[model samples]
Target chain A: MSTVQITRLSMPKWGLSMTEGTVVQWLVEEGTILEQGDEVIEVESEKINNAVESPAPGVLRRQVAKEGDVVPVGGLLGVIADAEVPDSEIDAFVEEFEATFVPEEEEAAGPEPEKVEIGGKSIQYLKMGESDATPLVLIHGFGGDINIWVFNQETLSTERPVYALDLPGHGGSVKDVGSGDLDSFAGIVAGFLDAMGIEKAHLAGHSMGGAVAAAIAIQHPERVASVTLIASAGLGEEINSDYIEGFIAANRRREMKRVLGTLFANPDLVTRQLVNDVLAYKRLDGVDEALRAVADSLFPDGKQANVLDISRIQAPVLVIWGDKDEVVPASHAQNASSGAKVETIENAGHSVQMEAAGKVNRLISGFLDEAES
Target chain B: MARRITFMQAINEALAQEMERDETVVVFGEDNAGGAGAPGEDDAWGGVMGVTKGLYGKYPGRVLDTPISESAFVGAAAGAAASGLRPVAELMFVDFFGVCMDQIYNQAAKFRYMFGGKAVTPMVIRTMFGAGIRAAAQHSQSLYPIFTHIPGLKVVVPSNPYDAKGLMIASIRDDDPVIFFENKVLYSVEGDVPEESYEIPLGEAEYVREGDDVTIVAIGRMVSMAEQAADALEDEGVECEIVDPRTTSPLDEEAIYESVENTGRLVVVDESNPRCSLASDIAALVAQNCFDHLKAAPRMVTAPHTPPPFSPALEDLYVPDPERVAAAVRETLGTSDRARA
Candidate 1:
């Protein structure tokens, strides 16, 4: 094999169902050095408008997918290499790559999320990177599922196995939220870990998921090696109750679109796909009741019903918050114990993992690595 | 452009387009994938009625075929939706809702309100309804009113292929739990449906035909009857406005009120039994909201309060037809009054 350092800027899959996306703009021109995680190109999928950061540190050699070009998932979008790489080789590589790239059969064959029976309910989960290393289980907050980790899961899984779960009453997991409480959800998570045969895991949660993770750390400490909280609830006394209530009550497109806007700092992140997705979920049979129970039991008003003391957490804790989080207040981070290495991300909101995946991933990976060491 | 496709095809196309546009949209029901088991023709039956045909081949695992357990799969669809998936569960027939209504009425409906407005359960339950096809009582019934009675649920009864495709697409994309009732008899009735994905906002009424003499608001299959009545009425010099309220839960009260406001005479046509049917509902709405707009008391043309007869002649008579609809409109605008004056 010829030793040639190459950067594969393939079409980015922002979410599970995004088979194609349009290149919105390129922030950096060709022939520029890009450190890993550096923003290079911004892309717009049906569900989100996200910036594709450099996966590896290298020179951005060529701009393959120009602005406004819609490319299929796995399609070659660009290339990166050291300045020493021959121009002729780069040209030949691009030609060969384009010639051989076959858009997978139009038969809808893509990543298949699996559902396993955990605690007498169907648990939907997406697992990536088949490493024997301790798996990282991502649990999303209220009204969220594995799709919320679409950006972070694939990136973080490169070093170790990563699994994103749709907690009960969320995602493809069971809708029967037995108690519709944090403890009930924690039990379900622990049961899922047991069913997956995972002895220990780095648990990461967003919003209400943070409380679920905290509950797990307190009750089933042995199963959790570390914890990462992103814009989590249960940390503060204040939450945007209006947003929650509006999200639950808004059934029409205009109403739902307006309600979902409150989750992000930019508000633009609540794309049409996101609204449609949330609406589709809301139409399911028992989902509404389960959601209502969770909402009433967890956060009755603007205040969180289940607040766990992070200082009592046995595992190493890493609390990540968006400085401008609108749904969950950013000041909640101050309540976290000083022992917990808390990082408040700027220009991010409640969905820090999606808004600033690169920064959040590095923080998560660094914390996970430290725990393993 | 409008093209002819089976009712099943219309539902399938609606689902396929919606899923393509929205990744969170998913489809699951009994035998939705067809040949999940057995040796011959792995993709055996797309569905019992084959309405979901070809979708399995196109969407693969997303078009899930569940066990005959409606409660389990329906509840699972609801559960999956609460978590992340925007699942569309097929009940096969509205009559089978008895086995799994708790998921729809209690669970899916209550999510938004009971959650203190923190939960959004965007889901759709599509089922075949109405009398015809010799499917008998168990398979045939107009149950939209039952669903419409529920505050949280949005009940949809598409009148034709165009409405079927657009309304089904809208139901899939809608944020609330919508009971999309497809008339089994009208599935084969072809009409224009746009290939590109578009949503016809729920609770909006469609003016099938404009008229000056009398306003005839119809539901589901009866809208076609009313349209035919309007065509016949046009030849007789009596114009009639035909309105189709695609959804009943988010009832187009404004549409009914507006038509009444304009025509000053109303005739509501419904295929369901007269008592407590969409006809009565519309009449009550007009009386309560647009009472001053009426030139005469509103008239309701509907099937008598009785189980649909199996005899073709009786069944045909039992359902509201163009003649009955035209007569109701004529009564609302009596030519004798003009002749006498």
Candidate 2:
């Protein structure tokens, strides 16, 4: 609606719980031209640190927030406009935006994660941005919770409803994963959709949850619109058993930190709070037994017990993996059917969804848009 | 969602949760159930600081109010623990431990070894310690180092609410007799604690802050002081890594050793007197094991070797503060303001 295009690249609200973020440093300076998805600034919340990307193609006109300054969610970080835009106009724009901007209140109205009993198992999920359009379902890997989508869920839910869930034996869900195999988990997720009254959804899963999504598409083809797998299992025969065994045996924060380091290419991403959180989860009652059962059933004898046929999938499929993935090989993406699309992100590991969320979200968004059309 | 509660509330929650899980667990102290049958308010004081306040109403018969004889009740706790009840007896003040030392150091500690490993004294003696309340010489003392000297006894001194809950649960479930020390000053200190029961394994140290310039190993309430020092030190272009050894008996020597070796400098901050305290213990550990890695003599900041004073000003000066700890850090780094002058 404006004759002069101006974009406010404010602080991104990564998850439901994040109220503010401190600007660590700016990667790109003002007056530099930026592409749609270039890394512009590094911001850190209490949970983790990540770089904020550009919203659109423009010349960064002014850096509004200084490094080390704490800014509330949606507060302005920098202004983006064309080079031909006058300085007076840009200043007016910045002044007008800050004058009208109000950070969110204490999150009383923000979305919250809810629990649903699926086949007598409590599964916690966060639902965002409701619409009649085909909903998108997010599935976390083994030993993960609904918080894994701290970077993906909110952005993907802008148009269609997105649901991120904690599988059995993880997060706030019941720490009872009966049999803890691919098909049992698949059935639980299928029942979860039924409990939520979601008829069909575009399913996306990471790591162990990927196998669950693929199994759903294979067994209950009617409930799946499309399938997206990120460094997924069920298509491959090999998994890093050391990481599996180490995760179950690491009861202390120091050992847990070393174990979580293998998940990311940049081990520095593994913060003290992350390790403490994982340790807290593992220390809960019955969680140790649940993880053991899941590991024994899923990765028996240091190898995947059941490798599904990705060829049997009826829904459109998109396979994404980090080229540097150490836990599960990226070469497994080669197993995708000719009809499916595959992508491998460079310099990311098994946790490609979290390490490179912006790129993964863009890829999934583009794939889902094409599939829906 | 993260819910912030006080350290006292955390300990109470841990007791409630463990009692709910294991029916054999029982709680008794001088005023834990202030007045049981002959009182207007059933759950009166909770304890001296209300740490066990409401448990009597929930589990009436289980929570008992003991007579003010520490030796008698403590010996009874040891007997109850050996006879099958996992009793958590509160020693009102650690200063009273002299009367119950034989029961703790001899009878309860040697059971498993003396009984050919067949017997276990699963007991926890929760007591209050520290000098900030101006309780004078008799009531205020940092005596955890004394318990750490005894065998077959686990010593836990938690610094915050989260650790308070986890360490309390762990101490309750431990097979050995555990001496759980709570600082009266930290009763109202708040931190995020989960509602569910969890355990932080004994002998593991928490890295409160990770830095490369120096290592500060602070015990109990000194952990927060070291954190404050680290923050001020950070502004001066010095990064200090802080290590909180949650348990003094089963010390994580490896963590302390590795941290000191990495930074090549150490400062041990303990609220106890310097002689044979955790500060000296850790300093000696690093000196013996990490000698080749040392860049300077390890400095220690501790209270003077004297009975705590009743004068408010002297008592305030008696306890270690952030400025003293930061000064010790600067002394080790050779960046002291005096050195600059």
Name the best candidate (by lDDT): 2
User: DockQ of candidates 1 onward, in order?
Assistant: 0.05, 0.55
Q: Summarize candidate 2's per-residue lDDT along A113-188 as a digit string, tens digits.
A: 8988898888888999988989999999888888888999989998799998899989988888898988889988
lDDT of 1 by residue, B69-137 (tens): 889988997888788889999898888999998988899899989999888888888888888776666
TM-score of chain B of each: 0.93, 0.96
Q: What TM-score, over all chains together, does every model reach? A: 0.58, 0.86
Candidate 1: tens digits of C-alpha lDDT, residues A220-296: 88889999988988787788888778877877656877887777777787765677667656655467788989999
TM-score of chain A of each: 0.92, 0.97
Candidate lDDT (C-alpha), each: 0.82, 0.90
Winning candidate number (TM-score): 2
Residue pairs in collision within model 2? B46-B53
What stretches of model 1 exceed 4 Å from their correct place? A1-6, A83-89, A107-111, B1-201, B204-341
lDDT tens per residue, model 2, B238-269? 77899999999899998898898889889999
* Residue-level error in angstroms, candidate 1, position A273: 1.8
